[model samples]
Target: MCNYGGGLGKSLKPFVEYNEPGKIMIIETPQSKSAQLSACWGPIESARAKVRGAEGVIVSGNVRQVDQFQDAGLPVLSRGIAALGPREYMRLGSVNETLAIGGLKVDPDDILLADDDGVVVVRQQELSQVIESCEYGVKHDEVVLQAIAEGSTMKEAWRKAYDLLGPPVEYARPFRR
Candidate 1:
């Protein structure tokens, strides 16, 4: 789930109101390309966010105390890590607004799915379609795996799966090899 917000910089001011359970906090720094900016998040904030029920965090800028973040049980994806905290170097920005992260435009309420692989954003309107496609892909993979387990070669497995499941989804076909 995704509930978009910024204001991750160091500040005495509290942002508790913006916290929403089961939501991922997406933060973007103003001058993200510059090395001067301090880490937007750290261990303490990670713990706090988790207490507030945040599923995870993603920062367009740097972060700190990565190990502590893991200890806090909050999954955080950041550009990099910084020794310095955001105090003095940066301040909280706006919340619940559109953000540009790595050339992708993230809007409020957009669904964010992340794992060791990476994060993928799905527009709110496209959620149902994306879920359907993913379900189809899982079924297709099951068929392929079953075929391969039954002594079929890789190519044969794919062919058998395709014959049983039809062609791969449009978006996934080009990568099917």
Candidate 2:
């Protein structure tokens, strides 16, 4: 992940070099005392990163070239888009350090699972437990699916799942308050 201001430095070579299979690039530019613009990269930069083997990019700020990025099949998540480029305003920020992203402290090598549903990060230390929970969830849902397939109503199948698997797990912050 990278923390930068509105301007993207002259080169994004470092980020491209760091890109590897199974790795996702996450960028953040929080609201600052300035105009608070977060301009990291546009579609062209996104394509470059993808070509270098980045699985996807998650931007906490704005990006440009939306249509091109989407057509290229490079997964990109951003708050919005802008016409401005980073030629004048870009600067190199911190990389591979703990960063505050969407109220979460993200670390290097953490597992990021993002989809239409949303994005979730599993710290490296809790990976095993998270995987086990995911496995259990898949199996539990399978039973509900089977019941629905067997002519049970959606509500009925869900009730059966609750009875069999117990209540859904409650949310808990990864770190202590």
Candidate 3:
């Protein structure tokens, strides 16, 4: 589930108890720089979250305890790292609610996909379609790469793949929001 904060005090029990295991923990702070007073969470809390079965955490603000988190194998994606703690600056703000982070509106249960490339959010209803498209793209790219390896020009390989796979049915439509 999602949690919102403005950096006040420390009480994450509600979030831990409410969040489902294997789901992402998204912590949204204010957009302004001044509001991010300290690190949102540290090693202790990361451990707590791991024990509770959280898949990972995405913080709009800063985070700390990088080594400890890495050792614990807990994935944490944040704005940056910090040494300051959150205990003195954060309090429960909102839980399981919608948040506008980085100009993107994120709602609870939205599919959050994060990898080395970055993060992408897919609405729950669009998950299946997105997956299908991704699978198709992967297969198509595989063909293109194979063709290129066999000495075809990049443009020729792309043309051959397109000719074989045909254009996507949704190519004419705008992307789903």
Candidate 4:
């Protein structure tokens, strides 16, 4: 789900209406210099999202009520937090549309995996390939770690692991040593 807007007033209804189990919500606010520094979501919205079965939420803008979001057990990733509400500072623009977030293009239904490290977007069409690559990477890492534990130098361990598994696939190269 992708929402292009500045406020949460009119947008929340449609956001709830389109709710689907296990779907991540991606919201984008206007990037103009004059845009208000108000929150796009708060504790109430977080509770509503959890009840509606949303997997998580990613806001390309601010959110408020930090403690309440944690209390509601909702995983919300936002650019920042604001004390002001959205009512006077923003207006709804669009929903379920393409959005440019942090210089990456995000479309509805794209797979978003986020953690303390950061967020990674996997296009729907590349899901299988990405999964396969990830599985292989995990196994490869284990082999390298084992070699290192057995007293092999870091470079030697990496070389031995590479020999055993062959070079990683192109997409998985960046993750490998």
If scored against the real structure, what TM-score would every candidate get?
0.80, 0.77, 0.84, 0.84
lDDT of 4: 0.75
Clash number for every model? Answer: 0, 3, 5, 0
**Candidate 2 ranges beyond 4 A from true positions:** 6-14, 33-38, 87-90, 145-155, 163-177
Global local distance difference test of model 1: 0.72
The alpha-carbon deviation from the true structure for residue 101 of candidate 2, after best TM-score superposition, in angstroms, is: 0.6
Off-target runs (Cα >4 Å) in candidate 3 are 6-10, 87-89, 169-177
Displacement of residue 148 (Cα, Å) in model 1 is 2.6
lDDT of each: 0.72, 0.72, 0.74, 0.75
Q: lDDT tens digits, residues 35-136, model 3?
A: 475787678778888988998888887888788777687788888777877653366677888877777788886888886566788887777787777777
The 10 consecutive residues of candidate 4 with the worst lDDT sum are 168-177
Q: Give the lowest summed-lDDT range of ten residues in model 1.
A: 1-10
Q: What is the lDDT of residue 25 in candidate 3?
A: 90
RMSD of 4: 3.9
Winner on TM-score (1 vs 4): 4
Clash pairs (backbone) in predicted model 3:
7-89, 8-89, 8-90, 9-90, 9-91
Error of model 3, residue 132, in angstroms: 1.9
